[model samples]
Every structure is written in C-alpha cells, then in structure tokens.
Target chain A: MEKAGWDGFEIGAMLRTFDGAIQNIATTLPEDRAYSQSSSFTASVADWRIEKPLFNKDYCIDCQFCWVFCPDMSIISRDKKMIGIDFDHCKGCGICVEVCPTNPKSLLMFPEQKDEESALVEWPKKVKKEKEDEVGEE
Target chain B: MSEIKKIKNLKEFSTSADRFEGANLLCPGCAHSIIVREVLNATNDDLILAASTGCLEVCTAVYPYTSWDASWIHIGFENGSTAVAGAEAMYKALKTKGRLKQPDRVPKFVAFGGDGATYDIGFQWISGCFERGHNMMYVCLDNEVYANTGGQRSSSTPIGASATTTPAGSVSYGEKKNKKDMVAIMAAHGAPYVAQVAPNKWKDMVAKIQKGFAAEGPVFINAMSACTTEWKFAPEDTIAISDLATDSLVFPLYEIINGTELNITYRPKNIIPVRDYLGAQGRFKHLFKKEYSYLIDEWQTRVDAKWEQLQRREEARV
Candidate 1:
C-alpha cells in the first residue's frame, strides 16, 4: 500500500561540490525519505507491475525464499514471521515466483489484470480454496 | 577479522528494513539491486553510503527522487571512495571532538560503484584510500561491463564476452584481455579484509560483508553482479546464471584476511565447464559457435588456472 499523507519534514543539509571540493561541511540531519520521495514511490510506477505473485499460503511452508529473493523487498516479514507480498510496491519482478522452491509453488507469477478478483488487492482475503480452484488447478 | 555474524536462515535475513527502501528504477532483473540489498542487510546500524555516478546512482537518485533509505552521497564518476573518505573523516573528527550528537553509534561508511568505476576510472582514488588506510569499505558490484553507459567494455569484462565497444562480429572476440584481478590487487594493498563474492551465494556473501564491516582497517569486496538486459538473459535466470558462474568456477567465493590468510568459501562439488555459464548469456553467445569452440577452451583454461591458484593460496594459509 502507498503510505501516503505528507509529513512535511524539512529537507536536510546537502553536500555540494564546487571545483572538486566538498563545501558546507556540517553535522547535517539524517534524511527522512518523506521529504523528497515516498519511500514507497514504487507505488507511483504501478504500471511497472506487469505481473503479480499469486501466493498459496496453504502450500507456503514459509521457506522465506520469496522474501529473500525479492529485490524490491516488497515481501513483508515481521519479527521473523513471513507475511504476504505488498503488491503496491512489488514491481512484479517475479523473482519470488522463480525462487519459490516448493513442489506446488507457494508463489507463482500471473499477468496483472485490472479485475480485482485476479489482482492482489484481495490477496489477504482470497482463501486457499479459491486460489486452488483458480491458480493451483494447473 | 570480526566474528562472522552467521545468518541462521533466510527468515532472519529478511527481517531488516530493505536498505534500498526508495523505489529504484534499476532494470527488472538487475543483479546490482540484489547486491545492494545484501550490502544493506549486512549491517543494521545507521549507514552513510557514497556512490559513484553509475547505474546505482543514476537509477536510484534522480533529483527529488531517491531509492536509498540511508544517508547517501554521490560525488563524481571517479570519486565514490573519495567522497566517503571525506565523510568518514569528518564523522570521526566530530565524534573525537565531542561535537557529534551520537558518538556512541557512529554510522558505518560504505562506498559502492560499478566495475567501470572500481576497476578503471576510480582505481586511483580507491588505491589512495587503501594506502591512506581509511576506515571504510569499498564494494565493487562488478557486472563485467559499463552496463549503465551503453554496455561499454570495462577492465573487469571477461575475455570473449561481447560488449558495445568490443563487438564480436567477424574478427573481434569481444574483450581481449583477462578481467583485472581486482581481488588480488586489493589484497596487495595490505587490506585487512579483501573478498570476492557472488551475489547469489547469500550465506557466504552476508558473512563476507559482516567480516568486512568488522575489519579494523580498509576492506574490499568484489561482488560479481549479473546484468540481465546487457547480458541478454531472461529475468528469471538472474540467480541461476550467477549460481552457474560460481559452480563453473568462473566466479569463486573466497576471502583474504590481512592479505595473507586466504579462505575459499565454496568449492563446487563438481566444477562444471565455463560453457554452461557462457552459453546462457547472449553476450557470450558468439563463443558457442563451432568455430568459437577454441574460445571456450581458452576461457575454461583461464578459469581452471585461477581456481588452482586460489586453491594453492588457501592451502598455503594453513
């Protein structure tokens, strides 16, 4: 999900180079990603989501392959508890689908469709019975 | 060398906030992004990243947009380390003078650049950093060529792999010279820690990074990153191709401590020929032809020789 709501943080002091020398050498504030870009700016490029992972939690033994291989880190893991993919930020790299080592893959990439049924919007609520009938049937 | 913080499993590794928290515009299957993630995950403390002007810098930080969650600075094409060295110097000075607010938890300084910058353009700065004994880690995400700048051949590009500048149409057989032995060169600098890691090998990669972080003096990690677009490989093959690279011994996993103690991290059970790794990528597709069979042999000979040399070094350490 795009974590929206501008928290108007001040842009920190920036290092500027002039004539090959760094200027404005000061103890600057650490950057708050909110100032410039939503750390979840990947959500803005939603069109980049060509494909989305269909997670079969039933088959997921929580091997954590999907979590580790995800370049975007869109796969959320809380306190060592592996959770579902955050589709908003997932650029549909399908790396999770490819790296899924399960027999009946816990994660499989499907073409992202506009329909809410096939889309990951309902991923958390989409039951195992329904997923088996649709994706796991193959 | 610091005690290698072993990641018990993948679950433990995934718990951290993704270092490159901002959305990056790196190509879909770029291994450089994965390498960046691993580097970020290597430490949990605050980080100050200094990046050179390459794929990582341009794609991640496009004015008013940034993919980095950590404090990052990009100087010039040839001064990733120089910038980081200055930052680290200032941090230490302020901390020593009790001027820094957070003296207890000073940030770790890391400099990252592609092979073009590391093996070529920024070599002088990197050498000076090592000689000057800067308290920083320099990571070279070596994807062979200058992929960001239209796939130009760099010193790290392997022989017989076609690149934009070194086209392999009729007479040319891609890059002419061997990939620069950067690991050895860094070790020669008397670095406290010098390692060569394949991004796909997560366990070894994480350990090497932790060790590099722990080292008291300068550290260097030459991480072999795969380029899906430039290499013309399927996005799915990113991990598999790098796995093949290590298995074939084209890319070995090892660490050099204090420039003398050598440890070969992973030796494949069966050393597959380099053809398996080469045949999978389009850049080396020309070398698969029957006429180019000799090229494969030449490549294999070099890889095997290097493996033997590495093995000898590891054995000598005992």
Candidate 2:
C-alpha cells in the first residue's frame, strides 16, 4: 500500500516522553512492528540504590577497570580519566568500589543521603591493599 | 576471516558512542548489560540484534522504554535462531532487490539467547539454524539459570548449585545432574567458528566477537554471564566471580575454529582452587558441608579432567 522504499523503510516516529504514571488510564503503548529508539535515559533508577560510590580523583589510576566492569554505564569519563559517577543513573551497586584496584580505593560507597562534601571530610582512612603481583595490564 | 584491527588503547577502542542509553532494568551487577555494551562497542559495522526473551530483553525493553540504541528485535525465548535466520534472509533479499538504503552497506546479524533459551527450550531450533548455515552468529549468554522467571534451574546449572527449582536440602543435593557441555554441542554442529568467552576479559571477548562476525557461515559463542541476583553474589563481586570461574577451569575461555582447531585462548597462570569459585557464591554454599564436601572434590576432578582433555586436543591439532 506504500511506495517501494528502494532504500529502506523508515518509521520516523520516535518516543521521547518517558513520563508515565500507573493509573487506570491506558498510557503509551509499544507500537506493533514500529521501530523506536530507547527512551530509558529518561527513567531514573537512582531511587533503587541504597548507597552510591563516591569518587576521589586523587587515587584513581585511570586504568578503566571500573569503567569496563560497570554493568550500568554510570561511570562518566573523558580521555580515559574518570571524571565522576553518573549519580542519576547509578544504582549504587558498589561495583566501582570493589574494582577500585591496588591503590587506595579511588571509589567508596557512602549512604545516599550523605552529602559528598561532608562525606569527604570524614572519609575513611587509607585502607591500602597489599599490591599483589600485577593482576591486569591495560 | 576479517582483518582484526589491533586494539592499542582501551581509551580509544571504546570511544564510540555508548550503544545503551540511560539505564533500563537489569540488576546493578548483572553481567548481561555490560557484555551487551562491550560487544556493541567493539564491532565496527552495523549489527542487527535479535534478543531472546530473557534478562537482557526484559530488563532493557520495558515496553515503551528501552536502553538499546542499536537496531534490536525481541523474538521471544523459544526461537532466536529462526528469528535471526529470517532477519538475515530479509537483509539479503533487500540487498539483491536494490532496496538497501546504502548499496555498499552490509549489516551483520547477531542473536542473543539466554542459557535457558539455548540449552533447554530452543535447542532444536538452534540445531536447525546451525544445519541451515545462515550468515549470522548465535550467542548464548550462559548464566546457568533461568534468571528472568525468578531463577529456576536450567541445563547449564552446575551440580550442587541451588536454584528455585533445584533446592539443596537433606533430601536433595542441589542439581543432581552436571552442567551441560554447550560449547561442545555447538561445535558438534560443525560450525566454522565456536567459542566460550567470559566478558570479564574484555580484550579476549572483543577479539572472539570480531572473528565470529567475520566468519562466512554460522557461528556460535557461549559467553559466561554472571547473575548478581540469582547467583547470590555481591553486585561488586560479579567480575571477581567470573574471573574465578575461568581460573578454576569451571568456565574455560577458548575457541574452536572450523569445528576442528582447538585453541585455548586464555590459560590461568596459576590455577586457583575450585573452592574459591564455589565459595564466592551463595548457590554453592551447601556444597561445603561435611555431607557434600565430596561434591567439591568431584567438581575439582571433573575440571582437571576437562582441562587435560582440552590440552590434549590443542596438542593433537599439530
């Protein structure tokens, strides 16, 4: 019923609105056979987390260990150096903390309610891990 | 085979835009999302992904909201192989009819199937796909359990690992049967390329994926996927557990080329005890008890035997 798309079929309709309430009213429904880009960026999983990892740039090795291991793309980085964590999307899994590597952990989990500035002031003392034989090379 | 571009730097290798936009609903430490992102990032061409209904599909695709940024399709749990073949067929037909938007463009096809989908329900469909020899890759994200429906035991679940359906108790010893040899079965299909990968080793995984894509015919890759929720390990310990699995030879990383050449890609410098791998997770906790201590020994013996067999096979190729 449509002209032969000699190149390809383009479903120009893309959904950007992610605000959906669980009400009696039927909200946005996924269209049948219609292509749409993911709108999950609009959904926040921050509330699902109980604690968030706090980053200390001074201790980071820029090895990208945390970045590679992060299941969620919450580790924000540029030019290999981790700038900060994407708090809005981070689920406080503390994976960054576990993978912080040989140096004094660059990242540590803190209560979500605690402010970073205050948390930094009383930051836990250096718990240096005994550097084992080189575990991983870049 | 396609020329593999050497990855000189990790920073530059993944400079491509993130394929996953925002967070969907995968658990904090689930390896499915990380593996998907890494696979998407490493490749250089457009890929049409067919996702089986599992953790990756359910979590990423929450109806109107999805985290996927690539051309993705959900084809249910029963027949990912058939869906992928159909998609590739469509792509070829469109190309021949001069309907392709880009004349020079060729989209590689990849189908992601959960362990349950591949091993339990969709085995025959996959076998048929392998026989048909479609120009596509079938990847089994083997997390060893039916993770989507609250962690039921699948064929891939290791002995002594408890799942919702296979409870470890005085009357029972977790899963009575051993984990199925999925890679061997896939290789038996005579696929030109077959591999077992653990995404924790990103470099190895990337290389294997590139090779799989480059292969001319059907290929199968069984990638180890660690489930933080069902596996009962801390979210942070996901990579650690996966690494341990490799070192303990519970999940060896290797590739079978032309279904005959045996290449063990990564070998442990120092083999870690099987206990370290078992103890790291809650599902295998019962295996440590006095009554079930023998199970650990059996696991170790089995692992050692398998490792030896792999080494022998690698030697035989010469």
Candidate 3:
C-alpha cells in the first residue's frame, strides 16, 4: 500500500465533488472496506491498513500542529502529497496514527506480525528517485 | 485643590504631570501616549527600549523625530522578544565582566510592540524569553489591528470586527476568528508577572506599569491601546472608546501573578451592552444586524467565563 502511486488525474476529478482530500482518498480505497461519506467520511472497521494510504493532494492546512506535535513524521508530505511509511525507516511506533486530526485516522501502522505480506511490495519509486537526487547533489 | 499632599517616602514620588511632553510620537489622543506617559511618570530609571516595528516605531522614530527619551533600538517587526532578550543578555554579560559602570543605576530594559508583533509574529520568541527568565517588561500595545500598516486585521482583533484583511462583504460577515488570548499564552509559559491595563484610567495603568517593572522576572502587560486612524473613529474619541471598552467588559482591566493569583482592578459600576462598545467603532458597524446578535452573545459568554475563572482563581489564592 505504501509503494502504490496514486492516479493524480483521477484524484483531481474526485476533488471537484468532495470538499476535502480525505473524502477523495476514501473513494479510491477498495470497496471491500465498506466506507461511506455522510457529512463526514467514515469506515466500517477500525482496520489499521486503510489509514496509511497516501493523500496526493493539496489538502494539508499546514497548521504544522501535525508536524510539530507528531511524535513521528510518518505522515509525511513529499511534493505536497500526504505519503506514509518509509517502511525501512518506520518503527511502527503508532504515534502518527494517534496525532492525526481526521475523525477517522489518516495514517495507520500495519501489524508487525504481517511482515511476509508487507515485504511482498516494492518501495515507492519516488523514494528511489529522491535518494538518487540526493546522491547527485552530493 | 484641597490640602496639597507632601512627599513623605517612596510612595510620595507619584506625580500628575506628564513626563512625555515633546517626546511622544503618538497622535493626539492616541492610547500609546497615555501608556508612555504613565510608564515615564512611574520611574526615573535610565531606560533601554527595544521597540518592534509598528505604529509606535514608524510614528515616533521616523527619521530624526525620535519620541523616545531613553536609549532605544527599533528591531524589525515580530522580533522584539529576541532583540530585547539579547539586550538583557548583553547587559548581564557586561555587568558580570565588570565592564558596565554604575551597575546599580544601569538602565531598566523594556520591549514595546503592537498586538501584531506580540500575539502573532513574535509569540514564539516572547515565550522563549519568558521561559529563559529575562528581567524585562514586554508591553503589547494592542489596538486590535495592524493599524500602522493600513488597518489590516491582527491576532488581537476581536471577532465580528472588520478590517482591510478581514473586510465585511457579501460572502463573509466579519473576522471569523476570536481575538487570540495573548495574556493566557504568556501565562502558559510561566511568566512571573502578567497584566492587562487600559490607559484611559491613568491611575490604574500607572500602578500596573510600576508593579510590572518592579517584578523580579519577565513581565508582560497587554495595554488596550485605541487606534483612531485605523478604527476610523475621531481622534478625540480615544478616551471615550477606551472607557466604553471597560464599561462593556469587552476589554477588562486585570492582572495575573505567576499564572496563579488573578486580580480584577476597577470593575465598572455599570456594565453596558457590547453594542455600545461596537457602536463606537466603524469596524463593527456590520454587526448591527439581527443575525449578528449571536456574536454579541458569544462575546458575553466568553467574557463571563473568563471573569468567573479569574474570580475562582482569586478565591483559591486566598
């Protein structure tokens, strides 16, 4: 889930109908989660996996309450999109999940026991590019 | 006058005469002059002023016409705390090194800035200075708006008041946010002395200023300054507006010592409706509507809550 890159064009279209990025993110999630939006978006279960999805939009208010108060910068914004879990770096501390202001959690930690399933995915391509750029600058 | 009072002791040092005669850069009837005058009268100590860039800065220190009688430094907007904190540190360093002459008579340090600097831009630095235990007085001359910069809204501007930035138009009614509780913010940092004063009542204001300066540690005084030019009220209405504020309890006169003891000074005999205060300023004309009565109610609720909390604290202290 952390490695998946969002379709920017589709997200932009969804934003016209929704007031906030969280609502748009809810729409793209697999229907099996049984999410619904009634005044505010809500999910059926308190599943931790659904919370860690990337929000690739300009919805952050930049209150910095999140960053300043966040025990972990796990809910990070890269190029203005809310991305989650640099898996190697993430300690699964669950602090990011706790501080998020969204009614339904915005960033969640996948259970540590599910290591085999989580390791099956590749690291985000953007993360690789970022490392390469840093190397070039050095 | 009745039998003239004589100077007996330190208490007899009080005077009715204004010390800020030709030096005041504030406009006629401007509330800053009242505060400046009171501060001047309270002490003869050689002063070092750290002034933030605002109305007081632009008006008083404009080119050659400096209204400040003491040695003054005009730091950039929003860094009054850092500048004053540095000055305090330097003074302490010089004294410790035995480089400062007549150390006992060395100037008292003060940082003066408008609400914009104190409540918003310089809040972090102000908190930092307070926590570090700087021995100085920080005065926030709160006229509610960034008046010198063309009537823009500031963090201290009351809700439902209109300004250039928070203008009343079709889409919006007025400033959507409540005025920032700056005193509470300072108190949260564990400042030793914190007070709010209105200059219209000279005696009360003068007393608070003297006490604030005499405090052993960092002190913050939020003076309710009236800005005629920006509020679009008549210059002569400055005192009247200030009086209205107190009468309405919109801007109460109070003090907090070490974030514990709460003291209410001069509670008005007659508490008027908030409308009377609002009616005095053009910025609140938009709030005359029936729908906006809720805003007035909200203001009253907040005032009542604060007053009750203060009373409770005062009782607890006793």
Q: List-wise, what DockQ does each model earn?
A: 0.23, 0.26, 0.01
Q: Write the per-residue lDDT of candidate 2 for residues B1-318, one digit (tens) a residue.
A: 334545566666534446675568888888987788777776656667788888888887775566765567776787877898899988889988989877565667888989999999999988998998999999899999999999999999988999999999998878989998989888888899999999888889988988888888899999999898888988877888888889889998999988789999999899998988888888998998999999999999999999999999988962
TM-score of chain B of 1: 0.97
> What CAPRI grade goes to candidate 2?
acceptable
lDDT of 1 by residue, B36-142 (tens): 88888777667889899889888887644566666788889999999999998898788778898755665678999999999999999999999999999999999
lDDT of 3 by residue, A1-138 (tens): 111134322332111212233322211322222222211112111222222323222333332222221211223433333444333223233334333444223333444554533433422222222222210011
Q: Cα RMSDs of all predictions?
A: 6.6, 7.6, 27.0
Cα deviation of A52, candidate 3, in Å: 71
| Stretches of candidate 1 exceeding 4 Å from the true structure | A1-43, A114-138, B1-6
Name model 3 segments beyond 4 Å from true: A1-138, B1-25
* Model 3: per-residue Cα lDDT over B63-176, one tens digit each: 323444345677689788778789889988998899987666646678889999888888888888898999989999999998888888888888888889889866666788
TM, every model: 0.87, 0.88, 0.65
Expressed as tens digits, the lDDT of each residue in A23-72 for candidate 1 is 21121211222333343344345468777776766667777777666777
- TM-score of decoy 1: 0.87
- In candidate 2, chain A reaches a TM of 0.64
